[model samples]
Target: MTFKVGDEVTLSTRAGSRAVVEYGPYGPNGDIYLVKLLEGDEQGEVFGALARVMSTPVFRQGDRVAGFGGTEYSIVAGPFTAHDTWYVVKDDKGQHHPHGDDRLTLVSRAPKPVGPTYELDGVTYDLGARYRDKDGDVWRFEVINGEPRGGMNGKDIYGYSETLAEVQQDYGPLIKL
Candidate 1:
């Protein structure tokens, strides 16, 4: 692929070496890139290298990234020359997929919800979560459309809570029925 100025690249012959593409192509050397080396003994040095010998890897190995389709992938290996600087990534199912740097975007990972699902007394609760009512009865709480609802048989319709803590506070062990 054609590279423009400010693109991060590495050389095919040198491992762990990085550079930044400076000037655009010019003349018979139109395929050659003018770059400032970012690492190695040649750090801070400016030189020209053939475009075919340069690789542009957008991220380091072991980064969690997402493609345009929103599929999450873990970068396993790469920036090696196999037609180009390709990154090997693994999916949730442990399947391996290859991608170029330009195809991915770094994204923040979402936190997994906690809870083991609870079933106590006659109440069945999802995620092992429960609250004690004023009558000393156990109730399960669920959030629906941003509203916290409570019930005894996994269907809370009698009591409503603005938050999970509110449900516990209003109907907890400390509260009297």
Candidate 2:
């Protein structure tokens, strides 16, 4: 199969080695290709390999994935090559890190939003509604002046169930007014 530049592929001759298609297939049948190795001792080295010797990568950049057998998700930092299986991940403390792709599972590219309606204390609250938290702090459950309130930061409130109980179960409790 023909491969393009930036495509992460494996080489038949180097079994498990990852490389990126750098240059052309100048041979008569367009089978020859120049690939740069992405892993091992020869990382950054280039070589000429036949089309039959190159296979496409299993994962691509921007793919949402989970690693370490955890529920937290991360984005693929780049092409999944032997050397850079790094993922753009954030820890519990909200710190970013490059995580390895061991036992990684692909997740949906984006989560489904739970909509702007929330039910609490037999009352329904929509976006921009004011609510009191357990700490007695009042906040609007909407984006105010381009800023998020009531812990409605994109990551904190979006993609959760529409029920207040469900949201509280995941993101701490918020008392009803």
Candidate 3:
């Protein structure tokens, strides 16, 4: 439940991805930390979560899992997409199934994967191609990781997925369970 400032963690109860820990582990009100979400609708804003629900993801491709008396399975997928998404897992006998977000309790997450990334002022931003600085200026990138990166960099770093409903048509489909 303890966390350092740079730790990437998830929320056990609901949608969250490789969000960064911005502050706290404060006592007196149960250990809590403020996390800045890197994806989904809440990107760039700091929110709080009890330390109990925050932990380093320990699962990776090909890891083993088992229910109390259920069949053994292997993780055939990665972290949930858009925070609250599900995982696509496979069983020992070779069958892929989409498991609920809660099923992640059987396993944790591995380090956050690096997708499309760009840098400005030495700080690297991922997932989204556009970003706004503390000064509230908008900037755009024509390409990142060889793919078209779209979004608005004003007020906040809003990804194309957040700003546009036609994201799949332009950016391609997101990872599904």
Top of the candidates by lDDT: 1
**Tens digit of per-residue lDDT, candidate 3, span 93-113:** 688887754555554443444
The TM-score leader among the candidates is: 1
Overall lDDT per candidate, in order of appearance: 0.64, 0.58, 0.56
Arrange candidates, best TM-score first.
1, 3, 2
Runs of candidate 3 exceeding 4 Å displacement: 64-73, 77-91, 94-165, 168-177
Tell me the number of clashing residue pairs for each predicted model: 6, 0, 4
Residue 128 of candidate 2: its Cα lDDT? 43
Candidate 2 residue-wise lDDT, 10-124, digit = tens: 7757744668989986789989989987654466889899887677643455456667766565553443344444456654556666666565677755453333765556656
- Per-residue C-alpha lDDT of model 1 across residues 82-106, encoded as one tens digit per residue: 6656788889999999887778787
Please give each candidate's TM-score.
Answer: 0.47, 0.34, 0.41
Itemize residue pairs with steric clashes in candidate 2: none
- The candidate, 2 or 3, that scores higher on lDDT is 2
Compared with the true structure, the alpha-carbon lDDT of candidate 3 equals: 0.56
Backbone clash pairs for candidate 3 read 57-109, 58-108, 58-109, 59-108
